[model samples]
Target: MTDLLWPGDARAGDLFTDASVVEAMVRVESAWLAAGGHPSELSTAFSVRDVAVAAEGGGNPVIPFLELLRSRNPEVAEHLHTGLTSQDVLDTALVLQLRDTAAFVARNLDRQVAALARLAERHRGTRMAARTLTQHAIPTTFGLKAANWLHGVLDARDALSAAADLPIQIGGAAGSLAAPTALAGSPAAALERVAATAGILGLPARPPWHTARAPFTRIGDAFVTCTDAWGKIANDVLLSSRPEVGELSEAPAEGRGGSSAMPNKHNPVLAVLIRRAALAAPPLGATMHAAAAGAIDERPDGSWHVEWATLRTLARRTAVAADQTAELLEGLRVDIERMAATLTAARPGIDAERRKMGDDGPYLGASDELIDAALARAQGKPC
Candidate 1:
């Protein structure tokens, strides 16, 4: 089936292209060759299509990729993947791809946080009915609502950044440096090669983590958290944009958000898609968690194979969701008059509460202070 659901226009769209993945794999291979003090020059004259058919024979792409490399570079072919295995090359390449992806997602997240901060500051005093259990319970400002989103996005961004800063994977056949030591003349020299590979890829230098899957699990969780934060905003948007509520609406764009059957419908398309991503991400993350749980022995049997597509799907969906969230916040429309009208309509409940307890000032206790604290945190000041 065609991927009609996710639209790709920016940096996030191109990071995981087949060609980019192949390039990353080739780069990893070259880094390994150079780290081993071998002739690293090899042919980059093959495409993913060239290796796709032959990949099934070995259950991974690296085997066929090595064949193509050998065919193209007869002189350096013998030393192409000297002490490396398929998992090493593929995992390191995946890290390289995620390095780029994390940068892209972080930029979009910064935009989203900035947009939300502005909204929170601008709407600090716009009174709206605060609902509990789908019913109006008290008065609150839209600023406070936006501040809640801002807090979530800020935490999500930090979590993603820390999780994406993962170490490069460089284990030989089995999470042991035996082959690398044999090739490099000493165990210390073998570790140096791993460090060199880390330097080349701009990832952290750490011991082999072929079977230690916590890093991948943490990264998956971070992606899910991103969708979790954005999904909450989308949920609120879906509810607030209702015709009956009419307190918020997505800003109109040309040739966008029109219903197929209804001519007068302006659908909440961005929020809908973000919510779709939110729903889709947790299961993918769970797959990684399950794989991690089942990862046994020197390497996993079938569990290791499950991570490739699962991580790619989760990362792609998250990148798209981050962009959608930023766009949603950038063009979000808040109806101040409607918020005031809704608050006015909820006055009967407010009056009933006031009769029970003595009349208080608007029942918006500490909302302004909470908004101030959120803004302070956004500005790097102590809240």
Candidate 2:
């Protein structure tokens, strides 16, 4: 029966095709073929065997024919999978994809952090008015603000890298590897072999987590953290680019924005896109968590299935957003003169306070000390 309600096709360029995912599939397929498993069982377990093995075979082959295909072109389904369930391949594939996605995001985040660090250093002492609760509060440096953003991005990058190390599921039927145990040694040995295979593929080596889904949930949480940082940066850019503020501007580049009415407008469309991407993260995370939480015993009926789609979607969206965010940050523009003017306009009240203080030193109380402390911390120096 053809399923008309199936989601659109996933292209080869999708983030799901990350190297980790490819390596994982290769590992599973290798294990299956090494265990002398029949292609029929494998086809039953992985419904997309044709799609997975089409490069080595012609059309859709029957179970018995698949074995012949496997033998004739052993390389066709080389290391094909055996003794594992669908969840093993699917879950492991997810972890692999996440690992690659995390790496991609980390690279971009590092670039943004370094760029912001330079911007912060350049504007370190350039004073600007600080706002709190939507009202002007005190004087602060534009560089300090950029430094704060860099710190947040750096923290998120570390978190994402840590979360990528979560284990993948590899247990067989009933999450006990009973079938593989009957064929090979004990279930423990079977699981160890699976873990070793996963390690060979660069995935984290750990016991099957068919029922325990903290790993998957953690990946989603990490993505949320990254998106939140990106969204905050975007929000700042949008606010600073406003006509009234005019303290910052998007770089004058092609493909920035479009308008039907306004001829002299350079909207912060990239900032808006960043916000949209951040907004999309929570629902994806919620769906993943709900799927994990609904797991019943060793195998939650459709929980893992639900998780697969969301995980893939999350990876693709995150990669796109990360790439776009890096580009946006790299080309961001700041007007130091405008910033100074804005600050000077707001300094009359602060000057009044300073005048009231008589000769009690500088008006910036502890701010310089705090900045020094922060800078020291960032540079790995003790306060």
Candidate 3:
């Protein structure tokens, strides 16, 4: 819940707040009523702390939450939460929040990709030493490096987008819409109403996901992939900006990347933060994956709770990492002189690789063409 490290997603945090969650549940209830299955109205003045205090004892907040709402307006109690279970409300609310969160993440990813494209086009022919297995092995261009970064980001973004189309949960108690079938005639009709509600909420409509946790699992995996892509960029920045090999540096900014004891220390703070997010994501993802197996009955013990926290944190960290990577690339400084100087030290290694291929010089095969192809593909144009 403490998003101090990954702070670009303030809205994402707000979406999961006690009041916002209560509101989302009400929204779900309202959508159900609007489908003509029931009639109800929810009060926005419901006390959030009351539900929070009740849920503190390790049960779903929806129970006490509905109690408070019905007490406030007893007339609408029958229609409100009439057929839905705790997980139904919680899962639907989660998907609603995730849909909005995905929009912000998508924007950041697009900007990051565009920034990398520009960097690649600007330095298409700026030669640099390409390292493999932590050793210089071949001659390449900064453009190629940027292009590779762009490709990784594009792939991760695509994966994340696909995962973001989350399926909504509407199966009533025990993973069957039986409780609600009295109102909608059959389970299929109730699912139709659920799909309609999801359409309004901007979510993918499917049968009950009570026991099926793949939606959250895929989301966690996609975010982990995004963090990995950004981490690759960060790792390269950290290595290239080292004092001994100062080929790349973060743009100098006042009061940024300052050291506590070292006077002349200007670190790659953005990259470091991104790397931290990348490092933090996989463990959270592991928790989600593990939680999936624990989703035993219609309502398991603690697996869903694990998913709520883990998925939100993963999305927040990934969003922050994407935002930081874009900002880093926007003002990223590339020292052509330093890059050229490193090439001299890397000549022997490069020559060894070149001799193995019987090549005489820098064989930057199709790097420029790659940059052009990436740009064209980004622009939705034929390459």
Candidate 4:
């Protein structure tokens, strides 16, 4: 399913792949072993595809995965899991994938922000008609609009970056790792040692967080916010690029946005896809919140399972939008002459003082300060 909707960075795509799921299984098992727990040849019985097929029946990949692992090598079966439950493995794997995804998000966002900043700076005085409710209301600059877009992107980027420090989930079925430590050793000490091994794999196992669910929720919100930023940019791009408006356009490229029915037509394909992603995002985010509400009693019935696809889709879609936005900005074509033509007669009631701020003046209240703050945010620096 992701293969069709997915057309973005390779690394980002890899995070959600079947191979990645298997790789995570290996990491989790190895981490358990590294902590002085003895495990077996894991793949003795069922193959990778067999585990996946088994997951269809159990609603979780871990149950079948463990069964296959132990069945293949019974002698080492007892030493394998070391008291972890299916939820523990699944949840921790999610955190691991998200952790890797954060780096990809950071890279793409940085590129996008930088491109927008440069575009905004160049068009600081480029004027256009500011619209309210889809009607021309006042004069504004293309630079200010770009800056506004930059500000939103910056906010989303910060949210995602902060959310990136996701805590790994490592609780057993009932939300405790006690089953493994109930025998002799100190639970805290053993858990800490195992967590250290997890840390080595780049997934920081910072305490247990299976019930919290904040990490997933926060990331979902960030994904929604990020896509929304692109949506605004895409919406404006669509409007401004229209033949009637002609203020901006998707930079002309060979075989890009070509209409199948009309050879003469060139569509704003990137913006279209970005807007589509934004439209899809809010609903997905809502689902995550709804799922959070249902995460009751120690484990959720279907709520937790709901997020398995929702969060992945949300994050993946946002990543694709980010990459497309960066590419769009790189080749974006601005028609300064056309933009200025729209300002022959400004709206009657705009304040004279506000209008004096230059072409970008009236619509950009404190935009200079805002853009600076946005730049600081993009760089992950103190403002």
Candidate 5:
């Protein structure tokens, strides 16, 4: 899973990767063994590449992975994958991977929200021109704009939190706990095993969700929501950083925003990349929803298979976008002088119109109050 096109893959840390997915799947298998009162430590003899190559025979990595594990760890051969199907192993592993990814995304979004809060507080009265339909409409403050962005990101954070609080998938063959219950001697014991396994992985325990695709859909939608908020900020930055507008600009780094052919260009590359992710998110979300809708049987033929890579890609893009947004906000260079100048240039006509409508000054009604309210809301913890 090396891709030059995806900004997420180019970053330093491996948030989501082929190797990480294998590691998560291994964790799920280990947890299952531990819950069954067996030694949980499994062998690490197989490489990710080996499992992937072997997965061609089966539809997923779990089958081949278990084969390799069973061959290497003969002690746990009977217990490994005793009550779980491929869906159980893969879905639970995905949840674990999403759990870690959610934490990382939440941290970056927190950084973005904190930075926006600072901007809102600092520039509470820094007036600027408000645009409507891409035209100068009225007077507004930079604080209000930043506050607006903050509100959107906060909403996205909450959505991601709700989606991240997902339960572990432990349904046996055909979405039933039959095998586990028969093995445990009772359904209650089987559920206890599930709860115990979930506890080990720091996830909630729930009944079989093999057919219910809402959790995966929700994760996809959350990723879209996050990127939507980030895209709003990037769009604003892109428009305002135009040479003609000169209202905002990314703080310069040594190798950032340079052009290959043009010598005098300092393009807004960060926003461009964030916007790119934003544009791609909605389609991925739609794909998840489509998969959910087309999920027909206890285990879908192709729809369930469709989810693994789509969700992984969505997570990667969303996580990378969060990091980009945090960096964008951290080094955001707000040109208060340019904003004031733009406001001064555009306010007179609107002021005259307002005066004729019995207003004495620019009607910046509730701008300050709304910013305060947004900042107050931002005080709440990130999900």
Candidate 6:
């Protein structure tokens, strides 16, 4: 079966490669080639296409490529990557991918947030009994749940915005852009220009981070931020849809999930899928963190590489999860009758307790007050 996610899109594949990274490497190499002058010029002296092809196979091809560059044109090789190292290219590429992914996530989040806000307004006074640990807790307007979900999504959005400013690694051989510095005015200036290029491409600038993997770690955290909120909504849907609870359920639909023996089962398939993806996100975040920790100065000791697959998998999967969550929220089926029934069943106990205390029972005390305060604040009214 064809993969529901990713499929075979060029842009998706390019998230890991594409021309941006290649062009950056080429520009660095060309500068070195020009330093040699005319016949000794490095541009005509090396083949990036050849190097790229060799790098494609992975295991230690970079060393051989450098060897070839040095043998054929020693002067050009002298300036080739300059003080830069492979981690520079790889890390920068990862940041670029993250920046692009962040953009996509941001747009989708905006849409989902708007949709949820509308839902909240529509259900502002729709009363329901809130539950804690699967037991009746207190009365709450369904709008409050929507508002809580919105707050979480907004938090994730803020996290992504912050992560977008993380710096890209570009220090050469030993966490210093020394060689490029020697050829192109100053190493610091070269790094600045590299950072400018990265920023232009939507990545943040940072000091040389050859061994430091904090940037990637931050990006991983942002991804988790989004996934966690999405997971909460999914978990709520699953819990609310229980036959015993039945206050909410997936929109009635055909072909969601089925039982072969019992023809009456309509499963919350999307909710289940989203929950599964949410469960997968924390481990993926940990994998990225471990990879970042494993990076050595100017080189990765396979720790960074270890996270490559997991990061990519998580990125693609989370995108799918986000899309699914949005759809689920947009089309959710809330049963007013069921909500009333559940609340009615719990009202007697609540009323008895309230009578016993006279004024201090489980009356959702400040909840309604808080909601009224929020509404008043939104309307520019006095608190």
RMSD of each: 1.7, 6.2, 2.3, 3.4, 1.9, 5.6
Which scores better on TM-score, 2 or 3? 3
Pairs with steric clashes in candidate 3: none
Q: What lDDT tens digits, residue by residue, belong to model 4 across residues 154-180?
A: 888888888888766666658766765
What's the alpha carbon RMSD for model 1? 1.7
Q: Which prediction has the highest lDDT against the true structure?
A: 5
Number of clashes in every candidate structure? 0, 7, 0, 2, 0, 5
TM-score of 5: 0.97
Question: What TM-score should be assigned to candidate 6?
Answer: 0.77
lDDT (Cα, 0-100) at 339 in candidate 2: 83
Question: What TM-score does candidate 2 reach?
Answer: 0.81
- Model 1 Cα shift for residue 119 (angstroms): 0.4
* Candidate 6 to native Cα RMSD, angstroms: 5.6
**Deviating ranges (above 4 Å) for candidate 3:** 1-15, 37-41, 381-383
Clashes of 4: 2
Error of 2 at 9 (Å): 15
**lDDT of candidate model 4 versus the reference:** 0.76
TM per prediction: 0.96, 0.81, 0.92, 0.88, 0.97, 0.77
Q: Rate the local accuracy (lDDT) of all candidates.
A: 0.86, 0.69, 0.81, 0.76, 0.88, 0.68
Looking at model 5, residue 312 earns an lDDT score of: 85
Model 3, range 296-360, lDDT digits (tens) per residue? 87777788887876766776677777778888988899999999988988767677867888876
Clashing residue pairs, backbone N/CA/C < 3 A, model 5: none
Clashing pairs in 2: 29-79, 29-80, 29-81, 30-79, 30-80, 32-81, 32-82
lDDT of 1 by residue, 1-383 (tens): 11555653242667776777778888888888777776466777877787877888988888998888888888878788878889998888888887787888899999998999999999999999988899888788999999999999988988998898888888889989889899889999999999998887788989887888888899899999999999999999999999999999998988879988999999998899899999999999999989988989997887888998888888888888889899999999999999999999888884567667776667677888998888888787899
Worst 10 residues of 4 by lDDT: 37-46
